[model samples]
Target: MIAANVSSSHGEKPRKPPVKVLSSQLREGKGSAVGGGKPEVSIRRLGSRRPGSSGSLAVSVVWMQGTVLEAHTDQNSALLLDETGNFHITGVKNIPRGKPCLSPGKYVMVMGVIQSHSPEPVLRAVKMADLSHNAAMHRKMWKYEVEDLQQTLPS
Candidate 1:
């Protein structure tokens, strides 16, 4: 099995923006996002591809936690950071009321769906959360994931 880190940190939380992955290089089940304030969900980067059950038009739900390395929100759509890669989120709720703007460098929990076969999949977020308040938990998750990845790597 392949593996990847789930959470991320740089000593303290990243003050600058998170990393931005070129959409062209991502494989599957990668990306991060969040909105408003909600409980954090344990999510990690995916290392295996789940074959599209039927054929095309397959949607996979992905839960991810990471910093928003970059973001741009219009009236109805936004793109969140690059844990493994960036995500283009559409039809997301909780616009932060007034500004409807979210800054980079904010930690978040993202649950979205992606087309299993799309090379550059856009994560249509269904649920999102601000996990910055629980920085310790997110950082600890990174350690566990790294351990998990090590175990999965081939000798």
Candidate 2:
């Protein structure tokens, strides 16, 4: 069980790290052991109240190595890359309502929940913010499946 302490309220009192449950385990009541009580799930876990999440389990997404490959201001969008390759983030879909512009050359920190709908996992950005310039730590890693990437990218 991997656990890390983070202040989810973004304040003083620390909350327990969100647990990552196997989808099958969740379906089979395997998470009944976490809280020493019944598994108390928030929107970030498996609650149904949060919008744009479709009432499914949410997982934290942390992507650190990315470059802006494409920018579409008219659509308010950008493509990002990492060791795993490129992914799309669109203002129309990824950004929350009434959000600001996402410029090029900016290192973005996306705090969202991931949902797997089959072949790929989709990140639903709930809290998108910019990382401080010095906070970025880049490292070279192995390449991803290029042919598989070509299928997912926009033409």
Which structure among the candidates has the greatest lDDT? 1
Give the runs in model 1 whose Cα sits over 4 Å from its true position: 1-59, 94-101, 116-118, 139-155
The whole-model lDDT of each prediction reads: 0.45, 0.38
| TM-score top scorer | 1
Model 2 lDDT tens row, 23-141 = 22222221221332323222222222333423333223322234555666576555554444455554424566314435566555544333321222234445565543543452222
Candidate 2 wrong stretches, greater than 4 Å? 1-65, 72-77, 90-101, 116-121, 135-155
Error of 1 at 73 (Å): 2.8
lDDT of 2 at 51: 37
- Candidate 1: Cα lDDT at 15: 23
